[model samples]
Target: MSVQPTSAPTWHRLSPRMLAIHPIIELGRALPALVGVFFAGHAGGHGLLTSLAVAVAVVAVSITRWFTTRLRITDEQVQLRHGLLRRRTVATRRDRIRTVDVTAHLLHRVLGLSRVVVGTGTSDRKNESRIVLDGLTAVGAESLRRELLHRTPVAMTNQGSEPADELARLERSWIALAPFTLSGVVTGLLVWGFAWRVEGESGVDLLHSGPLRAVGHGLDAAPTALAVVVVGAAILVFVTVTSVIGYVLAFWNFRLVRHDGGAVQVTRGLLTTRATTIERRRLVGIELSRPLLLRAVGGARTLSIATGLRVGRGAEKGGEVLLPPAPVDRARAAAARVLNGATALTVDLVSHGLRARRRRYVRALSGGAVLVTAAGVGWQTGGSLWPVPVAVVLLATSVPLAADRAAALGHAHVDGALVTRSGSLIRRRVVLADHAVIGWTLHASLFQRRAGLSTLTATTAAGRQGYRVLDVETPVAIALADAVTPELLSQFRRRPAPAPRATMR
Candidate 1:
């Protein structure tokens, strides 16, 4: 149904694709509860009674979510109303809008559905971001985006190229690595391993009754240990495998088409799928990744962090990986194609100063220690003395490994792209907007003062700005920011036009 052209507030209907997403969401959320009910019924011999209750509840909840959810855009504002019982109605003026985004999960792929989300930066309320819109087909999302962008009044004249996705290859490889059955087993173990002590005692009692009564049976039994540990490991393996499988699901029928409107549309997915439309100028940064494992196969993942995403449910999770597990050349080509040389990039690891030398190894060592120690403790508490220490040692080994993975950052403007490398072991290549920077700052700490090192901070309208330091002369830091400062100032420059009155959307 079309949105009624009206001045008065009216409840509008969201796309059916939005409703269709409820079933998948419900299934994902209710899987644990479902398994519990099944085992509970068999163990407690309740037959169909308890099981039926769970089924009915699940169906009821899913149906309610699918049917009752609604969103509306009027002359003045956009409003999202959802929930059956404690209903939530979020309203915002059209003027507060900053960005809009669309994404499609692998599941959404099979159904030809894409999620469309809108983002705004104002915290007129609490720490909440602007409302997010979920579940729209590719075309509707495109139309909506164009309309919103046209009405939003950004610097349409200065718009550059559309943003690109980072980690697209890594995300794809992760999917290809998915072992669904194995992953499920791991999930079962993590969720049910704790339940086994209560398993023989009865699964039904735990669900209907909140208190869990621990039963001490044979702790040394191979089956019990195998059920939890071996099965859990297998589950992890499966998850990894499924991550690989995700590539197929997510990129199935993949196509990246350029529309005449200076935008890009990426359509891919297997079951209940999705498509996304990206306008050129909305991109803020491009992220590139070459994971340690993927490095062996020469894989590179790329994505973009655009004004597209906000922090909230639906589509506001910013920055989606554009190229999942593609060949390095292909991934780079795809990124370059989408960015058209204007994609934003971030510099995570610093190289121009002692910042890398001082904190890199220390942070890596501590991080490795904490991770390893936690794993070791978990293993030790499991009453297994062998795996606990083993886990700790393995984790401990990662400190130097991480350091090795990192690279030093030295940024230089190369053909409109700021390219730099940093991180100890995980070598990161930061490709960012060199000239689009909105602000810059230089600071020196007490230690930095002694070392004659000063940090250079570059600000953008994205989530945050980039911070880098140079250990060279104090003049160098200021010089480093000299090129950036003017750009930032120019972005904020005010025109001599007459002051205009602001009106509600």
Candidate 2:
């Protein structure tokens, strides 16, 4: 859909509700500083008046910013002008736009408003490349999202495109996969660190508080090993509960759909609803990720390998995620649907030879030996000796891990697509289209050269740019490159002498 001005092109202000909510958003963003101010006031340093004044100033600045900001949509581009003392304007060409995502947090949803972000496929700095329109009516935001996503330079008067077919919707049964998908250990450590910080800052021992103290007392009479087991179990339970709640909140009511103009649309989240449109043309490949725990449960997640998607920007939810964690079969099905019948090319990958396997063992065992040696030396120097045994056990375990990793590493070309499988702990199978590959790089370390092995990286304009087929036989790497793009590497290949003397013989 392309939106045009009814009369002369004119600038528009944000929803008036922004005046009420913008300040609150600003304060929320500065919450940590505000908390520090309150702590200072409680400690008899900064007075209550100082905290109040600081908050008031922040709100005043937010109001000024709200009033100064204005947006306008013209025939060729979308423009935003803002700032009080230093006025600034940003504009993005409509044809260059790759994604338009709408997000509504709890407060914004309550106010019937949402935020719109329009981005072009190329900027290193997200803020610089994207235009954000905050606090627009939900309906208005949706309209803008569609208009930006579907607009073309030649068709300025086209009506909004019809909604595309839904490819997948949230399934209640899929929720069972949540606990497996969540990083329970990491979440538990974060929670522990946050509690410790609060205790340190407030000079209150949270562990010795009423409920915690009672729990501690209950475990004090148990054997040391039993107490450790009890505490570990408690932590595991806590982590699992938190992980489940978080997974549910983040992916509540998730839906994936195929939108017009070859775009894929995703709508998800609970407290903060988000609608994201990704241009299908930008998608170069799909990654099927299986973490250790998830793999144990036969679950996997799908992420699009595409250009214009920001990585590590939105908590753990990067822009590339196409499907949340689900059963491995279901994930593969979703990938096929998203790719419009392109099945996963992960079957029957060409394996590296014995030399590669030997190299993996050497690398893993050497690293493990270093750690074991360090631990042993530390123990001899009167440090805690417990880690020495642990290090020895880990070193012994690396043998199997190395074997598994070597067995898992493989690559193959099928139906104009290149498939690469690697990783043991967190397996990732990448399926990239051959045509998407722009170049190839061959690298050989000293050991690799002696072992007649090399790493071949397929370079592309989209996705991670470089995807490797690691530790393949040197001839195989060259053959793979030639098979993928013959003309590009043909000149570098030495042609065998034509069967010369057959006629003479």
Question: In TM-score terms, which candidate is top?
Answer: 2
Please provide, for model 2 over 1-505, each residue's C-alpha lDDT reduced to its tens digit, 9 standing for 90 to 100: 1234333578888888888888998987665566556676767766577678889999999999778998888767888899999999998887888777788999899889888888675422345778888867877777766666665332332345565878888788877877776656667777787666656555667788889899888899889999999888887788688777777777898988997678898889999898888888777788888887889899888887766666544334566778888888888888888878775543687788888889999999998999999999999999998999999999999999999889889998886788898888888899988888889999999999999999999998665777899899988999999998988898888888887565654
Cα deviation of 6, candidate 2, in Å? 8.3
Candidate 1: what lDDT?
0.56
Model 2 stretches with alpha carbons more than 4 Å out: 1-9, 43-47, 84-86, 122-127, 152-163, 185-223, 313-316, 380-383, 490-505
Q: For each candidate, C-alpha RMSD in Å?
A: 10.7, 4.4
Q: Which ten residues in a row have the lowest lDDT in candidate 2?
A: 152-161
- Error at 371, model 1, angstroms: 14
TM-score of each: 0.63, 0.88
The local distance difference test score of each candidate is 0.56, 0.80
Question: What does candidate 1's lDDT look like per residue over 177-230, in tens digits?
Answer: 233213334445556755654454345456434432222233234577565876
